[model samples]
Target: MGSVVEHKRTDKRTGKTVTQYRAHIRRVGFGSRSKVFATKREALDWIRNNESDNALTKRASAGGKTLASLIEDFIAAGVCQYASQAHLAYWCDQLGNKLVSEITHGDINGALLSLRTRGGRRFTPDGIKPSGKPLTPATINRYAAALSAVFNFAQAHGVIDAHPMKGGKVKKLKEGPGRQRILTPEEETRLLETARAARWDGMYLFVLMLLTTAARKSEVLNLRWRDLDLGRGIAVLGKTKNGAARALPLVAEVRKGLAELSKVRPINSDFVFYDPKQPGRPKNVDTAWQFVRERAGLNDSDDPVHRVVLHTTRHTGVTKIIRNGANLAQAALISGHKTLAMLKRYEHLAADDVLQLAEHALGKVGTGSSKG
Candidate 1:
């Protein structure tokens, strides 16, 4: 609803009275707007124009948004994880120009299928190049899950009446078994020795923490001094991929390495792995890690199944814990794995070890029967 009111005021310079018309509008779900005009007709005209535009805007927002715009809003809301944000950004590049209402199940399915052959983008000295390897079903599912989140956000916000991914319009592909790569004793020894001699003084400590703590690369890099309690020999991860805080136990060797590194810690920063150039930020050790891995002869092949990467350190740590007689629950606590299913992948054991355990248990029963 709207109304127009007339007012009279004395002009200070001319010492004359002037009249003006003020038009005011108040509508539900909209902010009130008022404007003054010299003539009542002009005031009424402005109100009519604004009201008409407002009605049109309301109608358009219901179904006229582009996928990119909705993605922008979703990002602004800051509800998704960091990894999902990257996936969503990739979607913005793929379907940004398309209208939300026009997107169909086929469109999404086709996009995911295309990802299989297209592979992941990799940066090389020559520029961006496709990895040439087809994306695994698990990787493809991650992309699908990211897109599903956006559609879910749109539905909750009333931007769309129905979910495009609903009713299993797009299904998750079956993922292969998880990687079971673990560092052999010789490889672990060689890796640590190489890291100790690397030019980057922090390399040894960083690798040691990863191998000992079973923490992710990002989690280790983001570690701060305050997060550590040297007396307790534990590191508190305040933020993790699972959005839960967990504590990582520090071994005697790790505690010694950290103690030595803290002696050279910069006074201006709290980050344990603070960048030399930017004291306020954590150091990116990708190049350093690559150098150490190559020098250690760990990068002999491009095979993902056997390739030793940063994440392999986590896998190694968890695998070693299970091999050393720790159960799945104990390993999950150290690895910060939220589910036992995810932790099960690292439960690899040697055939000899399994046989020995079976013999040890049955041997006692056989001895008792012989005595009887």
Candidate 2:
């Protein structure tokens, strides 16, 4: 009930011909399945394993459940992480109509490939638009992982018998280094001045807190009066991206700004950046941020890494911390980076700083000339 077909194709990267095997399996009362493999042995092995598993689970019917329904059930189970919900919802939009049994490795793989090449839909001023840039390898992998979680949940609940993406059937793409952009002194000054003049009252304080505390945009925007301690010059982030609580040190300028902001705080809301129109919600700062960045000339660069965004302030803060004599561990404590590896991207030093450090350590070292 299975077959392996050999095919030859030119490798796009190497321009050399290579052989590939496509394994196909079909059993009574089961949908057809196929997967491509790099070697004949692999193809044969896949066919055998699938046939054996199908025989044992012949009574199970994954056909009754659609992927969309399964995704809804998975979401209802409360197992998905907050960040992964969007990615899982995307899979629902793509393959939701298909029955769980009809889904295959090739389907998932092709969808991921398309996601990498074509990017995803994004919201803009005009309306929904396709992203201008392709999703990075890391992003693609995240999408795949999120969908895989749905499949795993289905299998655990007896909604599906097998996972198409199991056992590393879908290989992850190699990810490059993370972005390391930091603002120059001139850029920082221009951004602050523009933010100070911004019509949005919270813009200046938000940007200042981002730079001084190295807090993420979400963290700063979600701040409440209870989270701040101006007397101790500290702000506690009770919830963070890494699921850990961390404290951010508020400098004199940041403390003074907050003190002023508190005086004008709305009597109705507790949020630091509460929307005036809807005091229950945080202010939508995206439009105001875009305006400020464009006015300050920070958005002139087309390169995403070089283009200044809210997160760029965090990078600038961490770099400045390191430049001002703080080691990686010390910087991590201030920036709330969960690990040194995650914080390593901000370990940038100027050539002048490196030269001075070298001079300071080896200025009086003597050569072995014996004075002869």
- Number of the top candidate by lDDT? 1
Can you give the lDDT of residue 211 in candidate 2? 86
**Residue range 296-351, candidate 2, lDDT tens digits:** 98887767667678888988888888889888899888887889998766655333
- TM-scores for candidates 1 onward, in order: 0.75, 0.73
Against the unseen true structure, what C-alpha lDDT does each candidate score? 0.83, 0.82
Off by over 4 Å in 2: 1-86, 98-104, 148-166, 349-352, 363-365, 368-372
The residue pairs found clashing in candidate 2 are none
Number of the top TM-score candidate: 1
Candidate 1: tens digits of C-alpha lDDT, residues 291-317:
889988888777777778989999888
In model 1, the runs with Cα more than 4 Å from the true position are 1-59, 62-64, 82-86, 125-127, 266-270, 349-352, 363-372
Candidate 1, TM-score vs. the true structure? 0.75
Candidate 1 clashing pairs, residues 3+ apart or interchain = none
